[model samples]
Target: MENENWKNIRVPRVSSIEKCVAEFDITQLDVPSGRFRIRIYENTNGKFMGFTNLKIKNLFDGYPEGGVGNGNSITEALEDTIKNFMENLSENRILNDSDFIFVNYNEF
Candidate 1:
Protein backbone atom coordinates (compact mmCIF):
# COMPACT_ATOMS: atom_id res chain seq x y z
CA MET A 1 0.00 0.00 0.00
CA GLU A 2 2.85 2.32 0.72
CA ASN A 3 4.10 2.07 -2.83
CA GLU A 4 0.78 3.12 -4.32
CA ASN A 5 0.66 6.57 -5.89
CA TRP A 6 -1.56 9.12 -4.14
CA LYS A 7 -3.54 12.17 -5.14
CA ASN A 8 -3.97 15.51 -3.43
CA ILE A 9 -7.02 15.90 -1.18
CA ARG A 10 -8.15 19.20 0.32
CA VAL A 11 -8.95 19.21 4.01
CA PRO A 12 -10.66 21.78 6.21
CA ARG A 13 -8.57 24.04 8.36
CA VAL A 14 -8.51 23.28 12.06
CA SER A 15 -9.86 26.70 13.00
CA SER A 16 -12.84 26.37 10.64
CA ILE A 17 -13.45 22.62 10.93
CA GLU A 18 -16.61 22.85 13.05
CA LYS A 19 -18.33 24.88 10.36
CA CYS A 20 -17.34 22.31 7.72
CA VAL A 21 -18.33 19.19 9.66
CA ALA A 22 -21.07 18.49 7.16
CA GLU A 23 -18.55 18.21 4.36
CA PHE A 24 -17.37 14.88 5.70
CA ASP A 25 -19.71 12.02 6.45
CA ILE A 26 -20.11 11.45 10.17
CA THR A 27 -19.26 7.88 11.15
CA GLN A 28 -21.10 6.24 14.03
CA LEU A 29 -19.25 3.57 16.00
CA ASP A 30 -20.83 0.90 18.21
CA VAL A 31 -19.53 0.79 21.75
CA PRO A 32 -20.19 -1.39 24.79
CA SER A 33 -22.90 1.00 25.95
CA GLY A 34 -23.99 3.03 22.93
CA ARG A 35 -22.72 4.85 19.83
CA PHE A 36 -19.56 6.92 19.55
CA ARG A 37 -18.70 9.93 17.44
CA ILE A 38 -15.75 10.07 15.06
CA ARG A 39 -14.62 13.56 14.25
CA ILE A 40 -11.93 14.24 11.64
CA TYR A 41 -9.67 17.22 11.92
CA GLU A 42 -7.19 18.76 9.52
CA ASN A 43 -3.76 18.41 10.97
CA THR A 44 -2.34 21.90 10.59
CA ASN A 45 0.98 20.52 11.68
CA GLY A 46 0.69 17.66 9.21
CA LYS A 47 -0.42 20.01 6.45
CA PHE A 48 3.15 20.92 5.67
CA MET A 49 3.98 17.23 5.50
CA GLY A 50 0.76 16.33 3.68
CA PHE A 51 -1.11 14.29 6.30
CA THR A 52 -4.39 14.46 8.24
CA ASN A 53 -5.07 13.66 11.89
CA LEU A 54 -8.20 12.20 13.51
CA LYS A 55 -9.56 12.13 17.05
CA ILE A 56 -12.17 9.63 18.29
CA LYS A 57 -14.22 10.42 21.36
CA ASN A 58 -16.80 8.41 23.22
CA LEU A 59 -20.30 9.88 23.17
CA PHE A 60 -21.25 9.20 26.76
CA ASP A 61 -17.93 10.17 28.28
CA GLY A 62 -16.56 12.63 25.70
CA TYR A 63 -13.23 10.84 25.93
CA PRO A 64 -10.82 10.60 22.98
CA GLU A 65 -9.03 7.40 23.94
CA GLY A 66 -8.33 6.47 20.35
CA GLY A 67 -5.71 9.22 20.20
CA VAL A 68 -4.56 11.09 17.09
CA GLY A 69 -3.93 9.16 13.88
CA ASN A 70 -1.80 10.81 11.23
CA GLY A 71 -2.20 9.71 7.64
CA ASN A 72 -2.24 10.88 4.05
CA SER A 73 -6.01 11.36 4.30
CA ILE A 74 -8.87 11.52 6.74
CA THR A 75 -10.03 7.98 6.07
CA GLU A 76 -6.63 6.50 6.70
CA ALA A 77 -6.27 8.30 10.00
CA LEU A 78 -9.70 7.16 11.15
CA GLU A 79 -9.06 3.56 10.13
CA ASP A 80 -5.80 3.54 12.05
CA THR A 81 -7.50 4.74 15.21
CA ILE A 82 -10.26 2.15 14.94
CA LYS A 83 -7.68 -0.59 14.46
CA ASN A 84 -5.80 0.54 17.53
CA PHE A 85 -8.98 0.65 19.56
CA MET A 86 -9.86 -2.89 18.57
CA GLU A 87 -6.37 -4.09 19.37
CA ASN A 88 -6.62 -2.54 22.80
CA LEU A 89 -9.93 -4.28 23.34
CA SER A 90 -8.50 -7.68 22.40
CA GLU A 91 -5.61 -7.18 24.80
CA ASN A 92 -8.01 -6.16 27.56
CA ARG A 93 -5.81 -3.17 28.23
CA ILE A 94 -8.74 -0.82 27.99
CA LEU A 95 -11.05 -1.20 31.00
CA ASN A 96 -13.53 1.68 30.89
CA ASP A 97 -14.48 4.99 29.36
CA SER A 98 -11.90 6.66 31.55
CA ASP A 99 -9.27 4.81 29.57
CA PHE A 100 -9.81 7.28 26.71
CA ILE A 101 -8.46 10.76 26.35
CA PHE A 102 -11.09 12.94 28.06
CA VAL A 103 -12.09 16.26 26.53
CA ASN A 104 -14.58 18.96 27.38
CA TYR A 105 -17.08 19.17 24.54
CA ASN A 106 -18.00 22.69 25.51
CA GLU A 107 -14.43 23.73 24.93
CA PHE A 108 -14.31 22.37 21.38
Candidate 2:
Protein backbone atom coordinates (compact mmCIF):
# COMPACT_ATOMS: atom_id res chain seq x y z
CA MET A 1 0.00 0.00 0.00
CA GLU A 2 1.16 3.54 -0.64
CA ASN A 3 2.25 5.65 2.28
CA GLU A 4 -0.51 7.92 3.55
CA ASN A 5 -0.03 11.53 2.57
CA TRP A 6 0.83 13.24 5.81
CA LYS A 7 1.03 16.62 4.19
CA ASN A 8 -2.69 16.74 3.80
CA ILE A 9 -3.32 16.27 7.48
CA ARG A 10 -5.01 19.12 9.29
CA VAL A 11 -4.41 19.80 12.93
CA PRO A 12 -6.76 21.60 15.29
CA ARG A 13 -6.26 25.25 16.06
CA VAL A 14 -4.82 26.28 19.37
CA SER A 15 -6.89 28.45 21.68
CA SER A 16 -6.34 32.16 21.21
CA ILE A 17 -4.98 32.41 24.71
CA GLU A 18 -2.29 29.77 24.27
CA LYS A 19 0.71 29.95 22.05
CA CYS A 20 2.17 27.11 19.99
CA VAL A 21 5.85 26.79 20.70
CA ALA A 22 6.85 23.97 18.41
CA GLU A 23 5.43 21.34 16.10
CA PHE A 24 6.64 18.16 14.42
CA ASP A 25 5.37 15.40 12.20
CA ILE A 26 6.32 11.80 12.91
CA THR A 27 5.54 8.79 10.79
CA GLN A 28 4.29 5.56 12.34
CA LEU A 29 5.37 2.40 10.49
CA ASP A 30 3.23 -0.37 11.87
CA VAL A 31 -0.40 -1.44 11.89
CA PRO A 32 -2.68 1.60 12.23
CA SER A 33 0.36 3.60 11.18
CA GLY A 34 0.12 7.02 9.67
CA ARG A 35 1.44 10.52 10.06
CA PHE A 36 1.22 11.91 13.58
CA ARG A 37 1.52 15.53 14.66
CA ILE A 38 3.17 16.72 17.85
CA ARG A 39 2.43 20.17 19.15
CA ILE A 40 3.86 21.98 22.14
CA TYR A 41 1.86 24.76 23.69
CA GLU A 42 2.70 27.41 26.24
CA ASN A 43 -0.12 28.23 28.56
CA THR A 44 -0.77 31.88 29.22
CA ASN A 45 -3.39 31.51 31.89
CA GLY A 46 -2.13 33.24 35.04
CA LYS A 47 -2.42 30.12 37.17
CA PHE A 48 -0.73 27.96 34.59
CA MET A 49 1.90 30.32 33.29
CA GLY A 50 4.87 28.01 33.61
CA PHE A 51 3.07 24.89 32.50
CA THR A 52 3.25 23.45 29.02
CA ASN A 53 1.13 20.91 27.22
CA LEU A 54 2.21 18.52 24.52
CA LYS A 55 -0.33 16.89 22.28
CA ILE A 56 0.06 14.15 19.71
CA LYS A 57 -2.60 13.73 17.08
CA ASN A 58 -3.02 10.96 14.54
CA LEU A 59 -3.21 12.92 11.33
CA PHE A 60 -5.08 10.11 9.64
CA ASP A 61 -8.03 10.78 11.89
CA GLY A 62 -7.19 14.05 13.60
CA TYR A 63 -7.55 12.53 17.04
CA PRO A 64 -5.39 12.03 20.10
CA GLU A 65 -3.73 8.72 19.33
CA GLY A 66 -0.83 9.24 21.74
CA GLY A 67 -2.59 11.29 24.41
CA VAL A 68 -1.40 14.50 26.06
CA GLY A 69 1.52 15.31 28.33
CA ASN A 70 2.12 18.10 30.78
CA GLY A 71 5.53 19.38 31.80
CA ASN A 72 7.73 22.39 32.43
CA SER A 73 9.83 21.78 29.34
CA ILE A 74 9.58 20.40 25.86
CA THR A 75 11.92 17.47 26.52
CA GLU A 76 9.84 16.21 29.39
CA ALA A 77 6.68 16.42 27.33
CA LEU A 78 8.27 14.52 24.45
CA GLU A 79 9.42 11.75 26.77
CA ASP A 80 5.95 11.51 28.19
CA THR A 81 4.43 11.30 24.76
CA ILE A 82 6.77 8.47 23.79
CA LYS A 83 5.84 6.51 26.88
CA ASN A 84 2.14 6.96 26.26
CA PHE A 85 2.42 5.98 22.62
CA MET A 86 4.32 2.79 23.44
CA GLU A 87 1.75 1.81 26.00
CA ASN A 88 -1.09 2.46 23.61
CA LEU A 89 0.52 0.43 20.82
CA SER A 90 1.28 -2.50 23.11
CA GLU A 91 -2.19 -2.53 24.55
CA ASN A 92 -3.57 -2.95 21.05
CA ARG A 93 -1.12 -5.80 20.27
CA ILE A 94 0.50 -3.98 17.41
CA LEU A 95 3.92 -5.36 18.24
CA ASN A 96 5.54 -6.16 14.92
CA ASP A 97 6.40 -4.44 11.65
CA SER A 98 5.93 -7.44 9.34
CA ASP A 99 2.35 -6.71 8.41
CA PHE A 100 2.66 -2.96 8.06
CA ILE A 101 4.74 -0.18 6.56
CA PHE A 102 8.22 0.71 7.80
CA VAL A 103 9.97 4.06 7.62
CA ASN A 104 12.70 5.74 9.59
CA TYR A 105 11.61 8.65 11.78
CA ASN A 106 14.44 10.75 10.39
CA GLU A 107 13.33 10.19 6.81
CA PHE A 108 10.52 12.70 7.23
Candidate 3:
Protein backbone atom coordinates (compact mmCIF):
# COMPACT_ATOMS: atom_id res chain seq x y z
CA MET A 1 0.00 0.00 0.00
CA GLU A 2 1.12 3.56 -0.68
CA ASN A 3 2.58 5.17 2.42
CA GLU A 4 0.68 7.97 4.04
CA ASN A 5 1.99 11.48 4.72
CA TRP A 6 3.55 12.45 8.07
CA LYS A 7 1.25 15.39 8.73
CA ASN A 8 -1.48 12.76 8.99
CA ILE A 9 0.70 10.63 11.25
CA ARG A 10 -0.60 12.52 14.31
CA VAL A 11 2.57 12.40 16.37
CA PRO A 12 1.73 11.39 19.95
CA ARG A 13 4.76 13.12 21.47
CA VAL A 14 2.89 16.34 22.15
CA SER A 15 2.43 15.45 25.80
CA SER A 16 5.39 17.62 26.80
CA ILE A 17 6.54 20.80 25.16
CA GLU A 18 10.06 19.46 25.41
CA LYS A 19 9.20 16.48 23.26
CA CYS A 20 7.59 18.74 20.70
CA VAL A 21 10.78 20.75 20.42
CA ALA A 22 12.87 17.64 19.93
CA GLU A 23 10.56 16.41 17.21
CA PHE A 24 11.13 19.47 15.09
CA ASP A 25 13.96 21.72 13.85
CA ILE A 26 14.08 25.43 13.03
CA THR A 27 17.57 26.28 11.81
CA GLN A 28 17.44 23.53 9.20
CA LEU A 29 14.04 24.51 7.85
CA ASP A 30 13.69 27.47 5.47
CA VAL A 31 11.27 29.34 7.75
CA PRO A 32 8.78 31.20 5.62
CA SER A 33 7.84 34.85 6.06
CA GLY A 34 5.19 34.33 8.75
CA ARG A 35 5.29 30.66 9.65
CA PHE A 36 6.11 28.70 12.73
CA ARG A 37 9.81 28.08 13.36
CA ILE A 38 11.32 24.82 14.63
CA ARG A 39 13.06 25.05 18.01
CA ILE A 40 15.44 22.66 19.82
CA TYR A 41 16.12 23.20 23.48
CA GLU A 42 18.47 21.50 25.95
CA ASN A 43 16.48 20.46 28.96
CA THR A 44 17.89 19.20 32.27
CA ASN A 45 15.10 16.79 33.14
CA GLY A 46 17.76 14.09 33.40
CA LYS A 47 14.96 11.64 32.83
CA PHE A 48 16.43 10.09 29.69
CA MET A 49 19.68 11.71 28.50
CA GLY A 50 19.56 15.04 30.31
CA PHE A 51 19.17 17.16 27.21
CA THR A 52 15.50 17.95 26.64
CA ASN A 53 13.25 20.08 24.42
CA LEU A 54 13.03 20.18 20.62
CA LYS A 55 10.83 21.93 18.04
CA ILE A 56 10.46 22.54 14.30
CA LYS A 57 9.47 25.88 12.85
CA ASN A 58 6.74 25.88 10.17
CA LEU A 59 7.91 27.93 7.20
CA PHE A 60 5.22 28.50 4.59
CA ASP A 61 4.75 31.80 2.85
CA GLY A 62 1.61 32.42 0.82
CA TYR A 63 1.90 29.91 -2.00
CA PRO A 64 1.05 32.56 -4.57
CA GLU A 65 3.71 31.17 -6.88
CA GLY A 66 4.20 27.57 -5.78
CA GLY A 67 5.73 25.29 -3.16
CA VAL A 68 9.24 25.34 -4.63
CA GLY A 69 11.26 28.37 -3.64
CA ASN A 70 14.89 29.44 -3.58
CA GLY A 71 16.42 28.89 -0.19
CA ASN A 72 17.45 25.47 1.13
CA SER A 73 17.80 22.32 -0.91
CA ILE A 74 15.55 19.28 -0.38
CA THR A 75 18.44 17.34 1.16
CA GLU A 76 19.20 20.05 3.71
CA ALA A 77 15.58 20.56 4.71
CA LEU A 78 14.89 16.83 5.04
CA GLU A 79 18.12 16.32 6.94
CA ASP A 80 17.28 18.81 9.67
CA THR A 81 13.64 17.76 9.90
CA ILE A 82 14.54 14.10 10.15
CA LYS A 83 17.29 14.87 12.63
CA ASN A 84 14.82 16.43 15.05
CA PHE A 85 12.32 13.64 14.51
CA MET A 86 14.93 10.99 15.21
CA GLU A 87 16.17 12.65 18.38
CA ASN A 88 12.64 12.88 19.71
CA LEU A 89 11.82 9.29 18.86
CA SER A 90 15.02 8.03 20.46
CA GLU A 91 14.18 9.92 23.61
CA ASN A 92 10.70 8.45 23.71
CA ARG A 93 9.07 6.06 21.19
CA ILE A 94 8.34 5.72 17.47
CA LEU A 95 11.87 6.17 16.16
CA ASN A 96 11.89 7.32 12.57
CA ASP A 97 8.62 5.65 11.62
CA SER A 98 8.08 8.54 9.25
CA ASP A 99 11.68 9.26 8.39
CA PHE A 100 11.42 7.92 4.85
CA ILE A 101 8.04 9.60 4.45
CA PHE A 102 8.38 12.74 2.37
CA VAL A 103 5.98 15.52 3.36
CA ASN A 104 5.36 18.82 1.61
CA TYR A 105 3.29 21.78 2.76
CA ASN A 106 2.47 25.28 1.58
CA GLU A 107 0.98 28.42 3.09
CA PHE A 108 -2.56 29.15 2.09
Candidate 4:
Protein backbone atom coordinates (compact mmCIF):
# COMPACT_ATOMS: atom_id res chain seq x y z
CA MET A 1 0.00 0.00 0.00
CA GLU A 2 1.14 3.60 -0.47
CA ASN A 3 1.12 4.09 3.32
CA GLU A 4 3.20 0.96 3.83
CA ASN A 5 5.69 2.14 1.21
CA TRP A 6 6.37 5.23 3.28
CA LYS A 7 7.21 3.07 6.27
CA ASN A 8 10.10 1.48 4.41
CA ILE A 9 11.62 4.85 3.52
CA ARG A 10 14.76 5.64 5.49
CA VAL A 11 15.30 9.33 6.13
CA PRO A 12 18.53 10.78 7.46
CA ARG A 13 18.27 12.09 11.00
CA VAL A 14 19.90 15.33 12.10
CA SER A 15 20.98 15.32 15.75
CA SER A 16 21.51 19.04 15.98
CA ILE A 17 20.62 22.37 14.38
CA GLU A 18 24.28 22.92 13.55
CA LYS A 19 24.10 19.93 11.22
CA CYS A 20 20.96 21.27 9.53
CA VAL A 21 22.52 24.70 9.06
CA ALA A 22 25.58 23.11 7.52
CA GLU A 23 23.54 21.00 5.11
CA PHE A 24 20.87 23.58 4.18
CA ASP A 25 20.86 24.77 0.58
CA ILE A 26 20.88 28.55 0.09
CA THR A 27 18.38 28.76 -2.75
CA GLN A 28 15.24 30.89 -2.84
CA LEU A 29 12.27 28.84 -4.00
CA ASP A 30 10.12 31.83 -4.86
CA VAL A 31 10.01 35.59 -4.62
CA PRO A 32 10.03 36.75 -0.98
CA SER A 33 6.87 38.77 -1.40
CA GLY A 34 4.55 36.55 0.58
CA ARG A 35 3.92 36.48 4.32
CA PHE A 36 4.53 33.66 6.79
CA ARG A 37 4.38 32.97 10.51
CA ILE A 38 7.15 32.66 13.09
CA ARG A 39 6.57 30.74 16.27
CA ILE A 40 9.13 30.89 19.08
CA TYR A 41 9.41 28.54 22.01
CA GLU A 42 11.99 28.91 24.71
CA ASN A 43 13.94 25.75 25.28
CA THR A 44 13.87 24.61 28.88
CA ASN A 45 17.50 23.57 28.61
CA GLY A 46 18.37 26.22 26.13
CA LYS A 47 20.92 27.83 28.40
CA PHE A 48 22.57 24.49 29.04
CA MET A 49 22.41 23.29 25.42
CA GLY A 50 23.04 26.76 24.02
CA PHE A 51 20.40 26.33 21.36
CA THR A 52 16.71 26.81 20.60
CA ASN A 53 14.29 25.90 17.82
CA LEU A 54 12.21 28.20 15.66
CA LYS A 55 9.21 27.16 13.56
CA ILE A 56 8.05 28.88 10.40
CA LYS A 57 4.47 28.51 9.23
CA ASN A 58 2.16 29.54 6.41
CA LEU A 59 -0.26 32.17 7.68
CA PHE A 60 -3.05 31.06 5.35
CA ASP A 61 -3.06 27.40 6.39
CA GLY A 62 -1.23 27.61 9.72
CA TYR A 63 0.93 24.70 8.62
CA PRO A 64 4.66 24.59 9.26
CA GLU A 65 7.02 25.34 6.38
CA GLY A 66 9.42 22.50 7.20
CA GLY A 67 12.11 24.95 8.26
CA VAL A 68 13.34 24.72 11.87
CA GLY A 69 16.17 26.87 13.14
CA ASN A 70 18.43 26.38 16.13
CA GLY A 71 20.19 29.33 17.66
CA ASN A 72 21.99 30.49 20.77
CA SER A 73 19.36 33.09 21.61
CA ILE A 74 15.94 34.32 20.55
CA THR A 75 17.33 36.82 18.07
CA GLU A 76 19.82 34.29 16.77
CA ALA A 77 17.12 31.70 16.42
CA LEU A 78 15.05 34.15 14.38
CA GLU A 79 18.01 34.87 12.11
CA ASP A 80 18.54 31.19 11.55
CA THR A 81 14.85 30.68 10.94
CA ILE A 82 14.80 33.28 8.21
CA LYS A 83 17.90 31.82 6.60
CA ASN A 84 16.41 28.36 6.56
CA PHE A 85 13.05 29.73 5.48
CA MET A 86 14.62 31.27 2.41
CA GLU A 87 16.24 27.99 1.48
CA ASN A 88 13.03 26.04 2.01
CA LEU A 89 11.21 28.61 -0.10
CA SER A 90 13.67 28.05 -2.93
CA GLU A 91 13.25 24.29 -2.66
CA ASN A 92 9.47 24.71 -2.76
CA ARG A 93 9.22 22.94 0.55
CA ILE A 94 7.27 25.86 2.06
CA LEU A 95 3.96 27.43 1.04
CA ASN A 96 3.27 31.13 0.61
CA ASP A 97 0.24 32.79 2.14
CA SER A 98 0.62 36.40 0.95
CA ASP A 99 -1.54 37.36 3.88
CA PHE A 100 0.52 38.07 6.98
CA ILE A 101 3.47 36.71 8.87
CA PHE A 102 2.39 36.35 12.45
CA VAL A 103 4.89 36.36 15.30
CA ASN A 104 3.88 34.43 18.36
CA TYR A 105 6.07 34.34 21.43
CA ASN A 106 5.12 32.12 24.32
CA GLU A 107 6.46 32.98 27.73
CA PHE A 108 8.02 30.03 29.35
Show how many residue pairs clash in every candidate, following the order shown: 2, 0, 13, 3
- Tell me how many residue pairs clash in candidate 2: 0
Tens digits of per-residue lDDT for model 3, 1-108: 232232233457654322212323334232222233332332224122111122222224211111111113334433554454444334443223222222342211
Give the residue spans of candidate 3 off by over 4 A. 1-71, 92-108
Q: Estimate each model's TM-score.
A: 0.42, 0.46, 0.22, 0.39
State the lDDT at 79 in candidate 4. Answer: 68
lDDT of each: 0.41, 0.46, 0.30, 0.43
Full-model lDDT, candidate 1: 0.41
Candidate 2 C-alpha RMSD relative to the actual structure: 13.0
By lDDT, the better pick of 1 and 2 is 2
Residue 72 shift from truth in candidate 1, angstroms: 0.8
Give one digit per residue, the lDDT tens place, for model 1 in 1-108: 442212233457734212212113223343433433445545334321111122345556655544334455666766664565555445533455444443344333
Better of 1 and 4 by TM-score: 1
Q: lDDT for model 2, on a 0 to 1 scale?
A: 0.46
TM-score of 1: 0.42
Per-residue lDDT, model 1, residue 53, is: 24
Residue pairs that clash (backbone atoms under 3 angstroms), model 1: 65-100, 65-101
Model 2: residue 2 alpha-carbon error in angstroms: 45
Model 2 misplaced stretches (Cα beyond 4 Å): 1-16, 31-34, 45-65, 92-108
Question: lDDT score, residue 53, model 3?
Answer: 25
